[model samples]
Target: MRFFKLFFVLLLYGLSLLVLPPVSSSEVVWSISARVGDNVTLPCEAPGVVDFEDVAVKWTRPDLGPDQFVVFYRDGRPDPDNQHPSYQDRVDLVHSQLMGGDLSVVLKNVTINDSGRFECQLIQKMENQKKWSESKPISTIVLKVSDPDPIEARVGDNVTLPCNTSDVVNFEDPTVKWTRPDLGLGQYIYLYRDGRPDPENQHPSYEDRVDLVHSQLMGGDLSVVLKNVTINDSGTFECHLIQTMMFGKRRKRSRSESELLSTIVLKVSDPGSTGNRTETGDEGGHEDRQRHGLTGSVCVVTVLSVGLFLSKKAKLSKSF
Candidate 1:
């Protein structure tokens, strides 16, 4: 009976090992950030890969849905049929031949909506076997795409909408455009091209009211100063960096391919009303502090009175 019981225990343990899946080695999750319209790469690599053609690599965003891969490469080419629509024509392997086991991919023209967690997986098929092994994760990356914070100003006060591209060195003589999307297309607040301000394409309302700091242009500072801001000037502003591309000895400007460096929200308020609100907030805070002090004083007095009464009662009882 004892022998049979020991055999049963061993059988259960052996079965459990087969039923449970093997634990995979952990990979570090990397965090990366990029501005809108910038090209960013997600790093991934599979070590000990000699023949890249025998293996397949897949980059996917699991949160998007099942099978919604960002880039799927198998059989020596990327299979875009199962890829997500948003990533179509925008993603590709860093190396077409998968050099040095590197499975990284370049994501071009990123937008704010592309911020999410991405995963890189590797699939390998066994020799002389038609079935492929389960996909194993090689890397995990969290991408954050964003713009600068909004700017606030009072009416009649000058405000600077900030935009910079110092990190991007692709363009030497890029055109800077600051425009309000609410003002419609072709109606820009300021346009800088060919080392000078192009006021001919600027809106009539912004005439002589907007200026750029030419001294700081070389540092990639495309900041614009809006003088004497009005309440009606409150809106969303976009800064576009247009790169000049060379085509057979001729330089052509591609406005459509411009990168949106920064988006700033300018809020202009009335100075008189702002001052009144500040005063009101200060008065309210002062009143609250006074009430708190009074309450604390009352609490101290009550505590002292109880202690004094207790002391006197004890002395009277002792004398009796």
Candidate 2:
């Protein structure tokens, strides 16, 4: 009976090893998009992290220059020997979440230079076991950076709306679209393709007012200039691009629709009386005087006071 019991225990242990999976086989990937100056959290966790306080976790950014050590942990504390200087005070781990199989880190004050792929690796140590099993990439986070701030402009003045690409642009078969949500769909402010504006599909209000003033579309400049802007032009403007690429030895053509390169807010303000004050004319002066309640009677009283003082001075000189 003792021999049988020992053999049974060995059999169970052998079966457990066969059923257990490798750490490298399990990995999670997540995509994150954020604007400039934002705080983001990158998650990394595994079911195997339960009850393992001694875990080795390291985050790295291979795309960025020089420094790759984003965060490194060993024996329950962070190691700062090879940490990147740019991420020194900006990166931190959540210990509460880490206890629950989560190795997530919160990055503060994110900048455009921080945009790239981030990899998280973890290894949990068994309590009674001498050997530690390292977990593969628990998470692969891709951070895409963009700037979505509004651009201010004044009415009756020309304004340039900026939108450009970081990659090479093919202008031969390019499609650029500028649309405003307030104007509804299909009523684009400007539509350019094959090197010319598509006036047939353009909105009548922006018929001759919109132009691709960049003059260097092929050089990757997609900025547009609006001439004689109106108050109605104030709204969100989206710039979409679609380009064709030739690939492979056969030179097969492929079309890839680009994401909205940028969405610019056009804030159109009326020139108002403030701007009209610059005109050098009597009408402008008269309007300004009325606005400030500077009546003609106040000016006449000042002139009479000066004349009375002059008459008194002549009488005093004769007496002397």
Candidate 3:
């Protein structure tokens, strides 16, 4: 009888261990960098999760104060009551189905103000009860955002407005658009898609005036060269990179995400004009100094030669 009781207790203990939820022991922190208007994903996962219905995930920025979460997901859906206002409509789970324990969240159109440390926590729902277990942090992500600088060019000069996705490995075959917002809506300065430049929607003013290095597309360089830029070209140029992703159980459905990778302000001015005086004046001043220095050296050499010749003649005459 004593032996049977001991065996029963051991069996119960083993079953309990098998039914208990898994806990993440990792405390690793990840760092990610992005530019303004870029979409970035912060990764988090809970292993051994057989059912997502009983799991709740919360992503919080501690600096935002207590109860202010970047994302609060419960009851198999997002709970927006406690989410921060700034993060509203700008955040979403990478996978709505929570496939393979992936609880990563995507932040879209991020700005510099979004730079901060984010924490992800997992809360386990109690069996046959309305209560939940204490939240356990499983991941930490630090995000940094920055803006691109403006580009300057002179009239009639060929200019390259830079845009690239080379930093992202595996990114391929994305549709690229360069648009000048000041040129009215739906009008683009350049457009490339379907492995070639589609000029059908390009602005008439930019016809035959812009070109992209198609050979470098695979390398992620989407820079466009503007030939003989005019003062009218001076405006904000935005580079949009649109990528299509297929997701779902069968991977049959498709969705597209557009990233505004670069916002460059082009300042085109005539040569030697006041609008470009600062740059042109600096170059002109440098050349003037160089010319003056060369002339001064030549004059010194000529003077010294004349004095030496005169001295030599005087010595010869005296000796004669």
Candidate 4:
């Protein structure tokens, strides 16, 4: 019995090494980053202790105050009425996945007015207890304003936008998605991941008209091709990407680091629609348009197309 007891104690001690450490009162762990006026997330992805109904969650902007808060969840409830005035409507919990350690905060309409550091704190106590206990970690959240590159395209025409990465070891897996912000959130004109088109997230209007533009991690080209464009297709397009491991990427990537690159403001314009309409009749249209003296600035052949150009996004992200 004595030997068995000793073995059990030793095993218990060893197992403790595998468990997550208890958070300390001095440490703070929550991160947020964003461009001015852009939505940002301050994530406090830390594991939680389950079944503790009396436990509480608190959010405070340390730079703003010692106890000032954007919001807080306590005693299994939220206190929005008592939330900090400035963050009353802007702060939200994406950390409902907190049980898995995801304590993320999503902030919308991010602007210069929303600049600062955020903290996520966990407090707990039994209903019968009068005192509350709290824990924290070492993490800081910061925000920055970003202006992505602009790309334009036209319907029935091909538009190319690149998802360039600065330094990736090897693109063993690559994903390219073209998004039409005009379609609202979570909408896609075309998406390609791992070199395959994802029909699951396809936009009905883009059916059969989208294709991969081109990709070569070595050169940081992840451009997607959109064909048979439409007027409604014009809007902001973001080039999303993720790195894939390749065989010879180490040495090559060591010279370069894996990085996420994006460009926004992809506009799809109506081709020749902006110009004066020539009477339609293949020969008549062509002859009349010319005879009518339609040329130069008047004939823009205007269509939305996005490519590697001196765009504001590149300048903002310092890609170029």
Candidate 5:
């Protein structure tokens, strides 16, 4: 009788082990970069996920404060009560591929203050289990932010506006638009899409004069050069990027995200008048200084872009 009792106890213990198994964990980290006012994707992919209908995903910035929810989703919708006020309308799941194990989130209108470390936690409901068991962290994403400063140039001279993507652009065909707030309605200074310029949609003043400096657009520079710039170019210039790509293999849906890459103020110095000058030199000397200023401005832009790229590359290397 004692042997039978011991056998029964062992059977019960084995059944309990099957019901409540030890949870495994992984310390995976990811680093992501984005510019100010850009819409970026923080990846948090998972594996072995059969269904997301009963899964719960939570994203938080623990460095900011305890229980600081960046975004949360469960029960077939976002949890309206726990999200932080600053990220209320700016955070969301990029696509509905949670079932395929993609819990990535898109952050809109990113600012310099948004840079920080984010944590993603995923919990899945088990069949016939009333209690919840936590899975290891899906990922820890570190957001690095950069700024695109304004530029200055002179009229009748060539100017290159610098703009680069924060992350690698994998879309089939991406479009970049350069617009001036001082222009008329429904018109842009430069419009490049699918590796070609849309001349019909460009402003008359910029036709055949503005072109993308970078021919190869795959994760490279998107800067444009404007020839024979005029005094009218002295205004706020905005660079916007749009791209469309397929999301998941099972879902036959496409997703597009547009990001405002940079906004620069071009201060065009008139050929006749030395604007913002103190009358400290002759006309010839003034022209030489103006040329020097333009060169210096371009150098500054180049340095800034190189610095940003180096920083991003360093962080990405460490993450991988």
Candidate 6:
């Protein structure tokens, strides 16, 4: 039978390459968490590979000190000659998908020491043999160093809540508290020493309402300015970080607390009115002011115009 059908198609193509199943390569799948100008996305998942679109991509940092290449490429041609000037221009390598090898990466304006640990590399060259496709073991993104975003005023509207902790340079002076829980009292607006603004221990309804307080206990600009906001101000605010933990030295001094809230929801207008309607409050304030008063929107529009002209004169005297 034609030599048993050509040896049964070469033993079914070598038993389908020994039952196939083998394509596990491509790391640094995805990992991201940021805050500092905010703009990040790094995901690289290569598999089985096929025409690596002229491979050659590198982004390193091997964990701070040493191996901080940052950027590099050759095949796809993008090797700023061995890039490293602190990642000139901030770093970028997302060449339109590069034939699906996807070496995604994008960073900019983030400051908090730029947080660390990042590596996405791939180098594959044919024609002779030059292979290397790595991905996992290294792919970490953390830029938690924060301070910014907390400002919304109304009442008397005179805000300057600039609690922008400029990427902390470590001088220690970030424990500013402010809360107006239903007007019960919870002050102490500013206390940043060594750089100014330490009004004794301030908190007499904001003593002077704080202003232009330039604080930088090393780099955290804990700004403050709340000129006039009424309606009993508002609540819920936090600006984290207060550390002091050094095990193995009999020492511990930690304190990470960041809270901010200067809300003022108060806009008043009416009060006391038999039933002509007008009672705004869920914060639009209105009730109070009943100092022996009763609203009279023009006597409720002349008693609904004399009860609609006596019901049209009793319906024309019952239609005559």
> Top model by TM-score, which number?
1
Q: How many clashing pairs in candidate 2?
A: 0
List all candidate RMSDs to the true structure. Answer: 10.6, 15.3, 11.4, 25.4, 22.3, 15.2
Superposed by TM-score, candidate 2 places the C-alpha of residue 184 at a distance from the truth, in angstroms, of 2.4
> What does candidate 2's lDDT look like per residue over 212-302, in tens digits?
8665484688889999988888887878788878888997977765656667877888877555655657687888889667667778889
Task: Work out the TM-score per prediction.
Answer: 0.58, 0.44, 0.52, 0.37, 0.45, 0.30
State each model's CA lDDT, in order. 0.81, 0.78, 0.81, 0.61, 0.78, 0.53
TM-score of 3: 0.52
Residue 260's lDDT within candidate 6 is 27
Clashing pairs in 1: none
List candidate 4 stretches off by more than 4 Å.
1-149, 182-187, 215-218, 243-260, 272-274, 277-320
Give the per-residue lDDT of model 5 (tens digit) for 1-320. 99999999999999999998666566469888876667889988765545676778888887656656898788778887867878876788977546467788988878778899888888777677664456667699889988645567777899988777766775457778899877888889887776788786688888888888877664667789989989887777778787766567674645453656766667787766754354646677989999999999999999999999999999999999
Model 4, span 12-32: residue lDDT tens: 988886785643544554445
Ranking by TM-score: 1, 3, 5, 2, 4, 6
Instruction: Supply the global lDDT for candidate 6.
Output: 0.53
lDDT of 1 by residue, 62-116 (tens): 7877767899888889998788988887888999889888889999768888999
* Error in Å for residue 88 of model 4: 22
Candidate 1 stretches with Cα past 4 Å from truth are 1-57, 63-111, 123-134, 141-147, 167-173, 249-256, 274-320
lDDT of 4 at 241: 57
Model 1 earns a TM-score of 0.58
Q: Which wins on lDDT, candidate 3 or candidate 5?
A: 3
lDDT of 3 by residue, 1-320 (tens): 99999999999999988998665577558999987767899998875545777878888987997768899888778999978988887788999878888889999778778998998887778886598776667889999888645578888999888877744633445578899767767788988766677898789989999888654475788788889999998887888777656677785735454556677778887787775778888999999999999999999999999999999999999999
Off by over 4 Å in 6: 2-8, 11-22, 25-36, 39-88, 91-121, 125-150, 155-212, 215-218, 222-320
Off-target runs (Cα >4 Å) in candidate 5 are 1-70, 73-148, 246-257, 274-320
